[model samples]
Target: MSKSYDAARDVFAGWEVDTEAALTALSQIPISMHCWQGDDVVGFEKKTGSSGGGIQATGNHPGRARTPEELRADLEFAYSKIPGKHRLNLHAFYMDTDESPDRDEIEYRHFIPWVDWAKEQGLGLDFNPTFFAHAKADDNLTLSHPDAGIRDFWIEHGKRSREIAARMGEALGSAAVNNIWVPDGYKDIPVDRMAARQRLEASLDTMCAEKHDKAHMLDAVESKLFGIGVEACTVGSHEFYLGYAIKRGTLLCLDMGHFHPTENIADKLSSVALSVDELLLHVSRPMRWDSDHVILQDDSILQMAQELVFTGLLDRTHIGLDFFDATISRTAAWVIGSRNMQKALLRALLLPQDRLKEVEENLDWTTRLMLTEEARDLPFAAVWEEFCERNEVPAGLGLIDDLDAYQASVAGRG
Candidate 1:
C-alpha cells in the first residue's frame, strides 16, 4: 500500500473503522447502470417512438448510440472505466431484433441479445416496462387510462415484461428486478382521482397475477410526484406505491429525481425500510426540477450512502443510476456518475457507525457532531485512489484523457 493509504488507514483505525473491510465491501456492491443513458431513452425498436413522458434528454449531443451494437459498445466502454462488476437496467423498448413487435406483443425472444450480452460480460440484468413514449401514452395516461382498451394494452405489456425479466434472471442466475413505472396522470385537475387509482390498482393486480419464483425475478413498483405534462397529478404517487408495495409484497423504487425538489430521499430510506422487504434506488441528481443531471459526490448522495450502511440496509437495496446528460460525452457521464456513487458508498463504509450510535444513545451530541465533521477531513481521497489502482481503472484526472480519446473515436457516429 502507498504511504498515503497507510496513513489514512491508521487514521481510520483511531475511530475503530476498518479501511480494508470497507474497501472489500465497496467492491462487492454493484451499481446497475441504466442503458437508456447511452441512447437518450431511445430504444432499438424498429418503430421508434417519441419520448413523450416527463422524461426528456434535452441536448443535441452528437455520437449518441443509434443501434443496439453501438449502445452495447458504449456501455462496454463505460463499464471499463467504472470499478467493480455491475448490472444493466434495460427498458422493454430496447428490443434487439428485426421483428417489429408492439409493446404488448413483446416476447422474451426479442431480448435474447441483451441476455446473451449480459452473460458474456458477467453482468446482471434488470428490466422496466416502457409505459411512455408511445401512441397510447400521448394523452399522459396509461395503465389507469379511462379507456379499458388502452389500459388492457399496457397491462399486457407489463405482463410480458415481467416474464422476460424472469427469463433473464434465470439465465444469469440472479433475481432480476422488474420495476414498473407508468406515466399515467393528469395535466390538469382531475374530477375523480379515486377512479383512476382504483383502475391502476386493478391493472397492476392483473399484470402481476402470474407469479414467478422469487429466486428468478422480483417485482418492484416506482412512483413519481409529477412530470412535464402531468403537472397537476401523478397517478403513481409515493403514497400510492408505498402502500401498494407493502400490501402486495413487492420492492418499492425510490428515484432521487422523482420526488419533490426539497425532499431528502436519504430520510425516506430508513422509514420505508421498515415496511418494504427490499428497495430499489434510482440515484440521480436533480436541479430544482427532475433535470436528470449527472450525479456527483454531493451531500445528498453521501447522506444516502451513510443511511444505507448505518441502517444495515445495504444488502436489501439495489443501487442503480438514472441520468442522461446528452450535452457532454455520455461515456464520461456514466463513468463519473458510477464512480461518484461508489465514492459515496466508500465514505459511508469508512464511518465509525457503532461509535456514533453509542454516543447518540448516551446523549453525547458534542462528540457525535465533532466526529462526523472530523471524518470529512480524513484521507478518503488517498484510499479511493488506491481502490481505483487495484481495480485497474483510472482515478482523478486520469479519466480526462481517456474520455477525450474515446470522444474523438466516436465523433464520426451519426
Candidate 2:
C-alpha cells in the first residue's frame, strides 16, 4: 500500500538516543524460529529418523528419551530443512528427561552438531541455563526439593555449564551463543519455602556470571507460574529477584505471555532495560490466560508497539519466536510460526511511533483501546482512528521476511 505516517518523524519526536542508526538497524532483524528437541522433538510418523521414545503419551506423567540415531537423524533433518534466510539453533538444550537421565557423550553431545551446523549455515546455536548443569543426586533441581536450605546448588551447577559453554564456544568460532532462555523459578507446594527461594537464586546466579572469553548473550530470564504450583516460583512479580540478579550482572528474559493480562508489562520492561540485567528476549502473543506462545499482533497493535518501543533497547532484543504445537509436523510448525511472527514485526514497522508514544504515556492504554474511555478529550475511538488512518502496511500478496529488505538493500550495492 501507499505510505502513511513517516517512521523518521516518529523517531525524531521520541528523542531516541541514536535515532538515525536505530531506525537503520530495524531492517536487519529477522523473526527467529525456535524448536525444542529430544525424543519428544521429532514426533512425526512420516519422518524417517523420528522415534516415539517407547514412552506412552497417555499418562498423568510424561516420558521422553532419545536413542543416538534418533537424535542425530532429527538434527540432520533440521539442518537440511533450514532455509537461507532463517537461522536455526537448539531450542533449549533438549531437556525434559526423567530422573537418572543418561549423560553419555555428555560434553560433546549438543556441541558437535551445533558446530557442524554453524560451519554449514555460518550461524550460532541457542542454549539455556539448565543446558549444561545437572542438579546431581544431592542438589535439588526443583524448588520443592527437601534441601531448600542449600544456597550453593546453582553456584555449583552453573559453574559446570560455564565450563561446558567454553568448550561449545570452540565449536561456535568464538561467537556468544545465539540465545539463552532461563526457565528458573518455583512451583508452590511450599514446605521449606525460603530454602526453595535460595536454591532458585543459586541456579540463576550461575547464569549471571560475566564471561569475557565469549560475549555471553543472555537471551531472557523467564519467570512463570504452575497450575497450582507445588514448588511455587519465588520470582513471580517480586522486584527484588531480578534486581538482585542484575546487581550481579545478568539480564531478564521477558516472556511476553507470562504476565497476567491486566499487568502493566511495558512500564515494567522499561525498568528492566534501565536496570543492567538483560541478555536476550522472547516475544509471543499471549492468548488470554494462556501462555500458548502464539503469533504476535493478537493484542491491540498500538499497545504492542508501545511495549516494543518502550524497551528502547530493541537493538539488544533477540526476538525469539516461541511457537509450539503438540501435533503438527516440525517443518509445518516452523513455517506456521515463521509467518505468524513476521506479520507482527511487519505490523510494528507499519505503526507510527510518535503517536504511539503519546497514547502510551498519557492515556489509559488498555481502556482507551478497549473503548472504556468516558473522558471526551481522550476519546476511545479517536486515537485508534487516527492510528489506523496514519499507519501503512507493505502492499503485497504474501508476508515479507526480514532478509528480503536486507537483500534488496544489498542488490544496489549501497
Candidate 3:
C-alpha cells in the first residue's frame, strides 16, 4: 500500500487514511513479475543483466541485475522504483524441445520440478495450460469439436497432472499445487457441451477424490475468445460457468480482461461477489483485441472501479497480478507490475462496499460511476495521466516519472 491507494482506500471506506494495518493493506498491491523466463520474457532481456532501456540507448535501462543473487537485489531496487508484495506469476512451458523424449513427455516430467523450483524462489507457476493448442492435429484438445479424441487428450492432461502432483507431494513431504487458466473454447462447432462438461466434471471428481495428493484448487476457468476464429466469450456465459465451478469445489479465476463488450461492469463485479470459494486470479492489462495482458495500471485500468468493487465485497477470493507486456524489457515489466497492482491493493481495501451493492443493483449508478473517469472514456494515454494524477505519485515511484524521464526514452524508437 503506497500513499495514493492508502488515501483512496480510507476514503472509499468512509474513513480517513490513519490506521497502520489499513495503510499497509492499501499501499501494498500484488504485482506479478514476469517470472516466466529469466532472460527472454517477451524477448526483453538481452544477454545477461541487460535490458531494452526504453529508446535502446537512454531511459530507465529496462533490465535486471546479474545472476540469481542479483534478482532480489534488482527486485529490491525495483521496489524502490515501484512498491508492495508482488504476487508474481511464472510459467514453465518447457525448458527445451530436447529436454525429453518428446514435448508431452517432457512437459509432464518437468512439471513438478519447476513448481518446486518456483516455491524455492518464493513464486507460483501456472500449470501447463489448455485451450491453447487448438487441436486440429492428432487428438489435440485445444480446439472445440464433436470428437472424443480431444476430450481424451484433456483427460490425459488432467490425469498426468494429478499423478505428478501426487508424486511431488510424497517426495517433497508436502506441497501445494494449483490448476489454473482458461482456454479458447471450441471453434468449428460439434463441441458437445455436455460431453466437455462431463469430462471435466469426472476429472475434477477424480482429482478431488485423490486429493491430487496435495492441497489443491482451481483458480478460474479463464474464459476468453477471439471474435473471428471464435466469437468473443460473452461475460454472461463465463458467469454461468464460474458459478457452476464453485459448486464443483473449484473456484473462479476472474480475468477482468475477459469481459465482453456488452458486459455490464456491475454484472461482472456481481459475479465475483456471488462466488463462495476462493476466487484466485491473474490480473493484467485490459485488451481490446485479445489477451495482450499488458500492465494493469496502464491504459487498461478503465475497468478497475468495478473490479475492485467486487473484490472489496468478498473475503474468499485471493488476487494475484498476472501480466504480459511486449513493449518493454523484463525489468521494466517487473517495475510496471509493481507500480500497477499496488494501487489495486489500496483500492480494494478502500472499496465502497455498501454502496457497491447499491450501485451494482442499480445499473445506472454504476454506469455513472464508471463513466466519471477519463480512463473509462478515452482509455488511452489521456486516461493514463488521470491514473497517475489520481493515484498521486508516492515517493520513489518509477512509473510516475515515465513521462518526463521517458520522453527521450522509448519514444519513436519502437
Worst 10 residues of 3 by lDDT: 50-59
- TM-scores of the models, in the order given: 0.98, 0.60, 0.61
Q: Which of candidates 1 and 2 reaches a greater TM-score?
A: 1
Cα lDDT listed for each candidate: 0.93, 0.42, 0.43
lDDT of 2 at 383: 23
What digit string (tens of lDDT, one per residue) describes model 1 on residues 1-414?
Answer: 789898999999998999999999999999999999998887887874655576789786778999999999999999999989999999999999999999999999999999999999999999999998898888888999999999999999999999999999999999999999998889899989999999999999999999999999999999999988889999899999999999999999999999888999999999999999999999999996678999999999999999999999999999999999999888889999999999999999999999999999999999999999988898899889889889899887788899989988887897
Give me candidate 2's TM-score against the actual structure.
0.60
For lDDT, the strongest prediction is: 1
- Give the residue spans of candidate 2 off by over 4 A: 1-26, 37-86, 89-105, 108-110, 131-157, 166-192, 206-220, 227-240, 277-279, 288-293, 300-302, 355-414
Error of 1 at 73 (Å): 0.6
In model 1, which runs have C-alpha deviations exceeding 4 angstroms? Answer: 48-51
Candidate 3 whole-model C-alpha lDDT, 0 to 1: 0.43
Q: Count the backbone clashes (under 3 Å) in each candidate.
A: 0, 24, 10
Per-residue lDDT of 169 in model 2: 55
